[model samples]
Target: MAHDALRDELATLTTEAADAALDDIDLVPTLEAARRMNAADRSVPAAIEPCLPAVAEAADRIAAAFARGGRLVYVGAGTPGRLGVLDASECPPTFGTDPSQVVGVIAGGDVALTTAVEGAEDDEAAAVHDLDALGLTADDVVVGISASGRTPYVLAAIREARRRSATTVSVACNAGSAAGRLADIAIDVVVGPEFIAGSTRLKAGTAQKLVCNMLTTLAMVRRHKTYGNRMVDVRATNEKLVARAFSLVQDVTGAPDAEVSAALEACDGEVKTAIAMLLTGVSADVARSRLAEADGSLRAVL
Candidate 1:
């Protein structure tokens, strides 16, 4: 696209529009300026409310993919890309999922996470190359995230994902965006203009963060990673998490501390297994077999 055409396209984005009310923002008192910014930030959730159905639908698809041993992949640029990576990185530690189960593909690669890669988002072919590296298959779900919803890199990745028979979802901050038009499920947060003109790193970034959180967290829940709101699949790899695992086992089993500690030791610090053993007063081996039979669902085993 020519510079003028690109500029005109950006001009049409809600995120790029300058809020007239903020024209006098520089002239305001410090507290007043802060209040104005806070007010703008506070409207983000409501803006996202209308997009919940789409987010939920995409999450359902993601969960189904997980059940089939498939993955949920995020593709994006700039702040949106960073948010996707942040969310993807948390899944394994939080839900005990393999790193391959949830993945993030950012434009400009690892270098883009901290430094701006000039013209990276405009490289359509780069997006295809990144997704292709993942060996994407029909069971996978690729979510393209872009604040403007017109990012060529994100659009290309989504298009490529669909071409490979993978499910595609889009998260953008505009109505009827190109990314949305191409995706099976489109989530438009529509958070309105940024406090500073065209600076999508602000409210638009927050909206994408919120949606990513919802998507991945709920997908994990649907995959039986949680047991009645408790993170049963937690990997107790740290002191804090080990403590949490003990507490979880105790809470679920309501067993004496000695028995809980013994069960945990027998289960190799696996909280769900410990809980199953104590609650059912069964051997650790029996608990393990029951959990496996129940598809790792603690509630189902109980």
Candidate 2:
């Protein structure tokens, strides 16, 4: 009976449906198979186009929460869980956000990220425990991701988030998913069936990745994490990043390389401060003060 119930839920999800067109994919030439796969991948973007309005709304909600000193949390299982973790982990280096500002909670904890924990996705109680550990609040935004839209762990997390009055957004590859029903905003990409039947790590994963990108990237933009298209808040932690920081400062200020280097050094390699100092001919201390006054908006400072 338990197996029957789970099978029924999966039956209703388009992500689990088999594609007859690719039935003989394994028998095809390597190049032909690759071409077919690439062709199918192209449809993911189109599937997400209609959901942009919902994605925008969710991003706005998240940005508002950030302004109010809130955090963004993603919860999921399997491939969706890894995607959430990837996005959350990237916030710091890409946008210079605090690690705590964005976080990912996967079923079975960090151990589930690499090695699949047996039955982890079915552990609803564990989901509740994980969300509780975060101390979810009304100011936080919780995004629940599941390719099937019915992962038990993800549904439980969304329910717990709702109970805490946190904003809940669901990303599902199927329309009218269980997770979607529980969220305040539902982003259903509905990318049809996958080439490899139930292997959602393909098309469904691609759709989820695109949606996650828009949510965090747009939220950061709203928070003044960039100066125009340039990622001015990027953390210059390595040699390549350090060079990119210098390049960004020079590009934005159009200052000589020597002046850019001097400003970056004076500002301790803070890209935004270096840009501000060069553009305004101010001392590093003055540039830092102006940035703080403008709420860290380089545009506003200039």
Candidate 3:
């Protein structure tokens, strides 16, 4: 009876529905299989188009929370969990945000990121425990991600977050899922069924990734983490980034390479500060002070 019930639930999931068009996928040649997979992937963006309004609204809520000194938190399990962690981890280097500003809570902890934690997604109690440990508050924004839109761990986290009065957003691949109903904003991309049937890590994963990317990127943009099209808040932590920093400074300021290098050094390798100094022909101290006065907006400082 339990097996039958589980089978029935799976059959109702959009992510689990078998695609009759790809019925002969296993028997196809390598090139044909690749082409078929690519064709399926192409529909992901279209599926997300209708969800733009919801995604933008969620981003605005997150940016407001950031302004109020609250954090953006992502909760999930399995592939959804890994995607949350991946996006959170990139915030610091990409937008120069503090590590604590964007947090990822995956069921079974960090260990679940690489290898599957058996039965982790089914533990609702563990989800509450994980979220509770984060010191959640009303100012925080919690994003719940689940391809099937019914992961117990993800739903539990959203519930706990809502209990704490935190703003909640849900990203799922199905319309009218429980997680979506529970969230303040529901971003249902509805990327249809997977090519391999029940393999959400394929099309569903792509839609989730695009939505997650938009949320964080737009939030950062709202917070002045970018100037025009440039990632002005980028942290130059390595050889490649350091080179890119010099390139960005020169491109934005139209200063000589040597002048850009000097400005960067004077500003302690801060890209936005260096740009301000070069553009305003001001001392590094004045540039830094002006940046602070303008709330770190490089455009205002220039």
Task: Pick the lDDT winner.
Answer: 2
Which regions of candidate 3 are displaced past 4 Å?
none
Please report the TM-score between candidate 1 and the true structure.
0.97
Can you tell me which runs of candidate 2 are displaced by over 4 Å?
none
The TM-score, computed over Cα atoms with residue i paired to residue i, of candidate 3 is 0.98
Instruction: Please report, in order, the local distance difference test score of every candidate based on alpha carbons.
Output: 0.92, 0.94, 0.93
Which lDDT tens digits does candidate 1 get at residues 1-302? 69999899988889999999999998999899999999999999999999989988998999999999999999999888999999999988789889999998899999999999999999999998998899999999999999999999999999999999999999999999889999999998898999998999999999999999999988888877899899988888899999898899888878888988899899898888888888888998999899989878888988
Q: Could you give candidate 2's per-residue lDDT for residues 97-167 as a string of tens digits?
A: 99999999999889989999999999999999998998899999999999989899999999999999999
Report lDDT (Cα) of residue 176, candidate 1.
Answer: 91
lDDT of 3 by residue, 202-284 (tens): 99999989999999999999999999879988999999999988988888889988899899999888999999988888999
Q: How many residue pairs clash in each candidate?
A: 0, 0, 0
Ordering by TM-score:
2, 3, 1
Weakest ten-residue segment in model 1 by summed lDDT? 252-261
Relative to the true structure, candidate 3 has a C-alpha RMSD (angstroms) of 1.0
